[model samples]
Target: MATFATSDQLLVIIDPAARQTDGESVRIVKDVLSAGAAAKVCLPEGPEEFARALGRRGSRRPVVVGDDRALVRAVTLLHRHRELAGCALSVVPVGSTLALAQSLGVPTSAVAAARTVLDGVERRLDLLVDDSDGVVLGALDIPPAPVRAAAVAEPVSAASGRPWLRTTYRSLVRTLAPRPPRLAAVPAPGPCRLRVEVDGATVVDLDQPVEAVSVTPGSSGAAEVEVRPLSVGAEATPLRASGRTVTVVGGDFRYRADALVSGPVRRRTWTVSEAAWALTLPAHP
Candidate 1:
C-alpha cells in the first residue's frame, strides 16, 4: 500500500446524475471529504461543466462522486490533457450500477467509499487506448449475437402483427436512435464479422465467423485477448492471446468497455499502457 501526505488538497466533482438520483449519498461524501482535508466540491450539471471543473482543479487531487461512468469520464478527460500519469484519483460511487467501480477495488457503500477516498493508498493501474484516442479502464467485450437478438425482436413484436409494419417500425427505430457513447462501447443489435489480431498474429480470420471476443488489460504489461467461436456441439474451445496490442477489423461491430457501451465501427485497435493511471484503494492490513 502507498500512502499520501495527510495535508494533500482534494477536488471532489459530483456527477449530475448522482445528484439527481441520490442526494443523500452525495451529501455524505462531501461531509466525509470536508472532515478529512481541504476539499473543494464541484457539481457539474452536464458533461461540459464536468470537463471544465477538472481542467481548473489546479493542484488538488480529484475525487469523483458518482458511478462507473463518472469515473471513466474523469479519467478520459485527464488522459486527453496528458495529465493522467501525474495524478491519482479517488471515487465515491453513487449510482444504480457500480460494476466498474467495484471491479477496480472501490468500496460499495457510501461511507466506506468516502473513507477510502480520504484515507486510501494510491495504486497504479493499466488502461487500454484505442486508435481513436478513446480509453477503457477495464474489460472490453464483443458479446455473441444471442445476447441481444431477443431485444431487437421485442420492439418488432410490440409494433403489430403485420410483417411490413414490423419492418417499417424497425427501420424507423434504427433511424431515430441516438448516437453511440463517444468513448464507451454500446452493443450492436446483432453479431458481426470480425478478424482479430494480437501482437501481429492473426487469431481469427474474417473467413471464419466468430461468436464473440474480449480484450482486457493484463497485469503483466500486456493485453489479454479471447476469441469465442460459434459452437456446433456441446462447446467450442476459445482462443486466447496476450500481447501489448490487439486489433480488430470487421464490417461494423459493437463492444462493451467496462460499464459503458460503444461502437458500430469498421475497425479498432487497442494497446495496453502499463501502469498508465492510478486510483485510491484501502491499504492492506
Candidate 2:
C-alpha cells in the first residue's frame, strides 16, 4: 500500500494569468492549505518562468493553484525532470477553466479542491511521452484543428507563455457549448498512413488519411494509441489500444496533441518504460 508523507510540504505555484481572474480564491486556497502544513506560493511570470520554478522544485509536494493548463505544466515539468515518480502532486481548481480538473474528478470549488489534499486518493496513471522527448501527463493526442493561437489547446508546459487566450476561449465556449467528449473533427487535407507494431508484430497499417493520432504511454512500456479519422465536423472519438511500442507513419501534415503541435513529419513513435505515476483521485476512474 502507498503511504502519504507525513512531513511533506504543499508547494503552491499560482498561474499569473489565472491570478488575475481568481486571485482572491487563490489566496483563500493558499491560506486554507497553509493551516497546518507549510505553504510556499509563487506566481509564474509566464510559461518559461513556470518551467524554471518547477525545475527548481525541491522535496516539496507540488500543489498547483490554477487550472488544468497549470496542472499540465507542472506535470510536464515533473515528467521532463524524470521526477514524476519521486514527487506526489496536487491541484486546486481556481479558474473558470476547469476541464482538466473535471477530467481528473477534482472538485471545482476552492474549498472542495483544497479538501482534496486531505481526502484525495492516489491513482497511478499513464504519462504520454513522445519520440521527440515531449512529456505529457494528460491527453497526448488530439486531431488537427484550425490553427488558432493557443485557442484550442495549451501545451502541458508554459513556454509560449501561459495560454490566456486558450483559457478564456475555452471558458466561454464551454459555457455556451460545454466541452463535450465528442469534439467536431478537424478537416484532414490528405490521408495519413499509420503503421503500428507491438513486440515486433504489426497490428494496424493503413494508407487512409487520419484526422489525428494520439499516443499515451504508460510507465511500463505500454501505451494507448488512438487514431481519429479525418471527417468534416466530426465529433471526438477515442481509438484505444495498448502496446509496448506504437509508431505513427506517413503524414505530410501537422496535428495537435493536447496543447501543442508537431510538424508534418514522416513518422513518430513512443516507448513507455516501467515506472508508474499517480494522480490524486478517489479511484482510477
Candidate 3:
C-alpha cells in the first residue's frame, strides 16, 4: 500500500477522447485536481503524444482523465517500459466508456474521481501479460466476440443538451435488448481444436474441439482459466484450472483483452505477473 500527501506533484494526462466526449466533465476534473494538488496537465492529441507524455512523467504520479481504453494505454505503456512496478497510477473516469474504471473502484463522477485522485491510497494489482507484450487489466476472452452494431438514432443537433447522455442511452438499450434467437436451420458455430496448457501440464488438447476459452488474472497471484469444449450428444462441461502461465496453440485465432482485440496467430502465451502494477483508488474502497 502507498499513500500520497495532498501537496504531491501530479502529471495529469487528459485523453483526447475524454475531452471530446465530455468537455464539461473534463473541465471539472481539471479544476478539482488543480485546486487539490501541484499538477501539470498534458493534453495529448494522439496515442504517440500520450505515450511520450507518460514516459516523461518523471517522479510525479500519473493521473489519467479518460475512459477504460486510456487507462489501459497508460498501463500498457508503463508496462512496456518496465516502469509499471515502480509507479502508481490514478484515473478520473470521464468518458463514454468507464466499465473498467468503475469495476476497479473508481468514482464515476468527475468531482468525486478527482477527489479520489487527491486522497486515494495505492493498491498493487495483478496483470495478465502476453508473449507479445500485451497487458490485460481486466479479463481476456478467446475467439473475440463479434462486435454488435449500435442501434441507429437520429443525430443530436446543437440543441441537444448532452451528447454523452445520448451515447449512454444507446449503450444501455443495447445491453438490455434481447439478443436475436439463433435460427435452427443455420448451424451453430463449430468448435475449434486448440491445445491449452496451464503452467506445464496440458489441460486441453487439439483432440477436443472447444467453443470458447476465458482467462482472468486471479487474486491469488495466478490465472483462472476455463475451456468450454464442444459436445455431440451431451452438453460439455468446461474444463477449468488455475496457474501462473497459460499457453494456447491452434489455427489462427483472435482474442479480446480488455477493450482491444488482437491476433489471428497460431499460438499465444500469457503469464501472471503477481502484483505487477499499482493503481490509486479511494482510501476506503
Candidate 4:
C-alpha cells in the first residue's frame, strides 16, 4: 500500500480532445483551479507529450482536465511506470464521452469538477491488470460490440455543370419521397466455447458454449466474474464468482476494456490489485 498527502500545488494537464471539444469549459476549469491553488498547467498536443508532461509531474498533485480516455491514459501511464501506488489523481471531465467518469462519481459540470479537484478526498480504488500489461479502470466485456459501417456519400465531379442543382434535387427527392422501409437481416452472434477459470478452479469448460462473459473489479479486494452460457431454448443462469484472478481461454476472441477494444488472442488472464490506485472524489458528508 502507498500513502498520499493532500497538497495545494498541482500540475494540471489539459488534454487536446477536451480543448477541441469545449474550449470554454477547459478555460473555466483552468481559471478555477489556478485561482484555488498554486497550479502549473500544460497543454499537450498529443499522447507522447501528454505522457511526458505526466512523467515529470514531480511532487505536485496531478490533475487531468479531459474525458474518461484521458483519465485512463494517465492511470495506465502511471501504472506502467509503477508510480501509481503513490499518486492520487484528479479529473475535471470536459468531453462528450464521460460515462466512466460519471460512473466513478466525478462531477460532470466543469465548475463542480474543478472544485472537487481542489477540495475532494482521495479514495483508493481497485484495478484490473491483464497478462499483456493492459489496464482496465472500469469494466471488461467479451465479444465487443460490432462496429457499424459508415455510409459513403456520392462524389460530385467539378466538370459537371450545375452540381448544386443536382445536389438540391437529390436532397429534395430524399426529403419528400416516402421510401419503403428496408429491414436489415443481420444475425446475432453465436456462442463461444471458452474455458473460464477463477483462482485455479474451473467455472466453465470448453464443451459448453457461452453467450457472453464480463469481468469487473470488485470493491472487496477481488474481481467479480460472470459467465452466461448459451442454451438451446431457455436462458442459462449466469455463473458468478469472485476471486483475485480470472482466466479465459478459447479461439481468437475480441474484448472491450473500458472504451478501447483489444485482443483476438487465444488466452488472457486478469488479476485484481487490491487498492491499486487512488482517485479524488467529493468529500464524504
* TM-score for each candidate, following the candidate numbering: 0.81, 0.69, 0.83, 0.83
Least well predicted 10-residue stretch by lDDT in candidate 3: 150-159
Summarize candidate 2's per-residue lDDT along 149-215 as a digit string, tens digits: 2334433434345578668766776688755465565554454666655555654567544656666
For candidate 3, write residues 195-229 as lDDT tens digits: 99999899999998899999999886899999999
- Candidate lDDT scores, in order, read 0.84, 0.67, 0.88, 0.89
Clashes of each: 6, 9, 0, 0
Clashes of 2: 9
lDDT of 1 by residue, 126-150 (tens): 9999998899898898852323211
Residue 124 lDDT, candidate 3, scale 0-100: 90
174: Cα error in model 1, Å = 29
Which residue pairs show backbone clashes in model 2? 47-158, 141-214, 183-236, 185-234, 191-209, 192-209, 211-230, 219-273, 221-272
Best lDDT among the predictions, by candidate number: 4
Error of 2 at 185 (Å): 15
Residue-wise lDDT of candidate 4 within 29-132, one digit each (tens)? Answer: 99999888888999999999999999999989999999888999999999999999999999999986788888888999999999999899999999999998
Write the number of the candidate with greater lDDT, choosing between 2 and 4.
4
**The 10-residue segment with the lowest total lDDT in model 4:** 147-156
Tell how far residue 158 is off in model 3, in angstroms.
Answer: 7.9
